[model samples]
Target: MEEFIQEAYSGIFEKELVKEIAETAALIDFEEGDRLIEINDYIRSMPLLLNGAIKIMREDPDEGELLLYFLEKGDTCAMTLACCMGQTRSAIRAIAENKGSVVMIPVTKMEEWLGKYKSWRNYVFESYNKRLGEMLSAIDNLAFMHMDDRLLNYLKEKAKVNNTTVISSTHQEIAYALNTSRVVVSRLLKAFENDGKIKLNRNNIEIIAID
Candidate 1:
């Protein structure tokens, strides 16, 4: 676990801080679709991604789940940091996008390190800024872009995070992430296939054009 932590976060964190994290953090593995954090759940720790991807999502009463962003290796969720600092329940849901592991650092250590470690403080602030930008981009997509364009962007992002051109998700799963109907997603996917943007498979999509 310590070696994994060092390899993942060595340059981002100082040596002493890395040692402390290795000693204090719990390493947890997750499978695809596993919920790491749920809405309204009290956050007791923050996750440092060691491998794979985690999807951060927001739930709307009427629209259901909407994808906020993806956390890749060496990243942590800014929302989790905020909730930990504020001592509040999670407003978003975090699900494992694939089989992976994370080092979960206790919330108690977050503040202590924030004041004690320069690297930790910089990481926290940078995470907040990056996540805020992503949130803004999501809002722009919803308010300005067409559903088809949004869906295309979603596929591109999913493919990038999964490190594959093929997306192994059903149309319904894509619909849930985009907060749209399966019928709508299916129609757009067919149109995308017709336009040479993607290839439709029985249960997956092969992206041909991504920009």
Candidate 2:
């Protein structure tokens, strides 16, 4: 785990600080579909993903939930940091998309690191910037793009994050992530199939091309 952190977070912090993190941080592993954070959960530690990916989602009381973005290797959850700093409950959910490991820093250590290490401060700021940009992109897709375009973009993003063009997701799962009905998702997927944009099978979608 120490070697893993040294490799994953190389150049992000100085050697001494890295050694401190390696010594103090708790290493944890997760399987796919495991919920790392849930709405209304109190977040006391900040997680830095070391391997695989996690999907962040925002819940709506009336509309189910929407996929906000993904946190891959070396990425940390900005919202988790914010919630911990403010001593507030988590408003978003983070689920492991595949088997992965993360190093969790306690809230107290996180605060101490920010004041003690310049690189730690920069990392927090950069995480905020990146997550904000992703949130804006998600908002643009929902507000400006049509459903077909949004669906295609969503699939493309999933493929990109998974490092494959073939996405192993069902129409219903896609609909839930996009905050739409399954029937609508199926209809649009069928349209994409007819247009040769994708090939659909049970519980999977193979993106043939994107125009």
Candidate 3:
């Protein structure tokens, strides 16, 4: 628990605060390909990814799992707020894309912790703002940008955040993120590969140029 707290926080709060919350939380371990949250399920708790990867996705008739995004070690999935706000159904499904661990805090307890600890409140505010920003960015791209610009921008931003040119997501996943078709994503990847800007290896695509 101390290790998880240490990895998650950078002195944003006193160690005591994190320890106190951790004492009341549960550590959930997941194997690869486990569903942590199903669509339309009531989200009773919030998960902070402690290790490995979790995928947040919306299922589609044609595309299957249209990935909304991922929750890495530092990420907290946003669906918990909907539940706490009295929503009965989850908008996305959270699945363990890889073997992982998450620290689960009851939504009620988390609210209590936030009210009692100013630092925790601040942390929650910051995370909320980050999510808001991402949503705004997505809306902006969808409304104003061309498909090529949006797709390239997405790839560049994703690569930047992951600190690598290689992205392990599939074409259909990127298409969903960019609000386009898989064929469009595939065509763009082919163009990039032909121009020596990226490489395609079946389901995974690599952006050869860092920019």
133-197 per-residue lDDT for model 2 (tens digits): 99999999899989988898898888877898888887788999999999999999999999999
lDDT per residue for candidate 3 within 1-211, as digits (tens), equals 8667667665775787778757877898999779889887987877777787776776666655544566676678665665655747787878776777888878777778777888878877777777667667666766797787777777776675455777888887677666567999899778878988788887567888735
Q: What does the lDDT read for residue 27 in candidate 3?
A: 91
Q: Kindly give the number of clashing pairs for every candidate.
A: 0, 0, 0
Compared with the true structure, all predictions reach lDDT values of: 0.93, 0.91, 0.74
**What's the C-alpha lDDT at position 206 in model 1?**
96
| Full candidate order by lDDT, most accurate first | 1, 2, 3
Better of 1 and 3 by lDDT: 1
Residue 129 in candidate 1, Cα distance off native in Å:
0.3
* Model 2 regions more than 4 Å off: none
Cα lDDT of model 1 by residue, 68-166, tens digit: 999999999999998988999999999999999999999999989999999999999999999999999999999999998899899989998999999
Model 2 lowest lDDT segment of ten: 202-211
- Top candidate (lDDT): 1
Q: Best candidate per TM-score, number?
A: 1
Query: Per the 3 Å backbone cut-off, how many clashing residue pairs does candidate 2 have?
Result: 0
Measured against the true structure, the TM-scores of the candidates, in listed sequence, are: 0.98, 0.96, 0.81
User: Can you list the residue pairs that collide in candidate 1?
Assistant: none
